[model samples]
Target: MTSVVEHDTSDQFSPATSPAPEATSEPAGRDGDGRAARSRVPALRTFLATAALVACAAAGGTYVVTQRLADAAFVSLEDAVLTADALPVGSTGAGVVTEVLVTEQARVAAGQELARVRLAEDPAQATRGPRTETLKAPMPGTVSRIDIAVGGVAGAGEPIITMYDHTELSFEAKATEEQLRDLRLGMAARVTGPGLGRPVSATLDHVKPRVGADPLLDAPLTEEQKVAHERLTVVLVPGTGDVDAVSALVPGLRYTAEVDTRTAVGRIPAVNSAG
Candidate 1:
C-alpha cells in the first residue's frame, strides 16, 4: 500500500495550463471600412462639379437670350437732352432801365413785377414828367437771362428777360433716317440721367424733319443723297402731371432715351421694297 501511494503524486500536485486565445478579425474589419470611405470621396466631388457646370451653363444661356430679346424690342439714343420753350419777357416801349427787381436764374411767378423802366421824354413836348413803368412776368418760370441792366436803354418790344417753364420739359434727340424708321409718334419711351431718381416714363410727341449739316461728310453730298439721309428731331414728353419727373429735369441736361418698339401704339406699317 505504501508503494502505490507514492506513485503519480508529483503530477497531481502540478497546476493546470489554459489554452491560447484565437486571433481577432476587428483590425481587418477597420481597414476595410477605411478603404470604403476613401472610395466614396471622389464620387461626391465629381457630383458637385457636374452640378456647378450645369448651373453656369444655364445662366450663360439665359443671359444671351435675354440680351437678344432686349435688343430686338428697344431703340436707344444717347444724344438726348431736356428741352423746353423759351418764354420771352419784353418791355412795352422804349425806356431806360430804372431798376431790376429780379436777378438772373431767380424764380418768378406770373404777373410778378420784374423791373422798372423810366419812359423817355418827348423832344417836341417836354411838358410830361418822367414816367416809370413796372414790367411784369408773363408766366411762372425760372429766369434764365437778363438782357437789360439798370441805366441801359431798351428798344420797343425788346426782350428784357428770358425764362423757361419747368413743368413743360421735353426730351429731345436727333436720329438718323434708319433709326427714325423704327420709331413712331405716341411710342412709349423711358428717359434716364444723373439726379433723376428713376427712369421717367414718356410718350413720343413729335417727329419732325429737321435740316442738319453732316460735318462728317468731307465731300459735298448730292442733293438726292442729302434727301435720303436727312436727320429727324424726336421729342418726347413725360407723363402729364408728373411733378416728380418735371422737378428732376434741368434744361440742357444730358440723358438717355429708350424707345419701346414692341408696343402697338403708333406702330409703323411695313412696306415692301420689291417692285
Candidate 2:
C-alpha cells in the first residue's frame, strides 16, 4: 500500500515539470553567438582589403600612362608670329556687320563666307544701293581677329576679314651671303634654327638682300647709316598632304628649321592658283 502511494505521487508531479520555465532556454542565440559572429568578421575584413588593393593598382597604371605620353614626341616653337597681315574682305563701302558667318578662331575653307555686311549709311544719289555679298575667304586660313562686332558700323575701306594667309608661306630666314651663293633660286635647303625644325622642305625663293642686318644678330649693324646686308630669305612648302596634317604645324610654331640642302620640295598647285 505504501509503494503504490509513492508511485501515484510521482506521476502527478511529472505533468507540472514538463511545462516548467527551465525546459526552454537559448543563451547562444540571444547573447551574440561567439563562433558565428567571429567568422563573419574575417570575411568582411578580407573584402575591404581586396577592394583597397584593386583601387590602388588602377591609380598607379593611369599615372604611368600619362607620364609616358608627356615624354613622347611633338614639335615645339619659339618667338614665332603670323607672317600675313589683316586682309580686307569687304569693298570700300560703309556698312554694318549684319551677319556673322563664322566664329573667331574658326577654320574656313577656300571660298567660304566669313560674314555679311549690310550698308547702314545711305547715299544722297546712287546708281544702285551698295553692293552686298557674303564675304568669302580667298584662301583657306584661320581668322586671327574680329575687329568689328555684330551691329557695329564700319567706315569705307574698313577690314572685314583678318584672314591669315593659309597658302604656302615663304619663311624669311636670314643667312649669310656665303649661304646665298650656296642656295640657288630653285635649290633645295634645310631650314632649322631657334624657331624651325626638320629643315621645313624649303626652296630658295630668291636670295634677296635685307634692308639691314639684324641688330641682335650683328651688334655693329645698327651703327652704320648705309647698312650692309648679307642674308638669304627662304620659302618653304610643307611635306604634309592636307591642310589638317599641315595644321599640325600651327602658325607661330617656331622650331629648329633644319635645311636639307639636297632635298627639293615640290611645288603645290594651290600655291600657283591653278588648283
**Root-mean-square deviation (CA) per prediction:** 6.5, 17.3
- Cα lDDT tens digits, model 2, 1-275, are 45544345665577765665664457856556777789899999999999999998889988988776543321122222224444666645788888877876677888998888887546674767665656788878878677787788877768776767655544544444444333334544334544343345544454334454356564544534322343334444444433233343445545433343333335322122211
In candidate 2, position 248 carries an lDDT of: 37
Off by over 4 Å in 2: 1-87, 125-133, 190-200, 209-221, 224-229, 240-244, 261-275
lDDT of each: 0.77, 0.55
lDDT of 2 at 187: 49
TM-score of every model versus the real structure: 0.72, 0.48
TM-score of model number 2: 0.48
- In lDDT terms, which candidate is top? 1
Highest TM-score, which number? 1
Number of colliding residue pairs in each model: 0, 20
lDDT (tens digit, per residue) of candidate 1 on 1-275:
45555476655565563445788999989999999999999999999999999999999999999999998888897778888788877777789998989987687899999989988876766887777889898888888778998999998789777788877888888666677777766788888888787788888777754345563376777776675456556788888755556654568888899988877454542111100
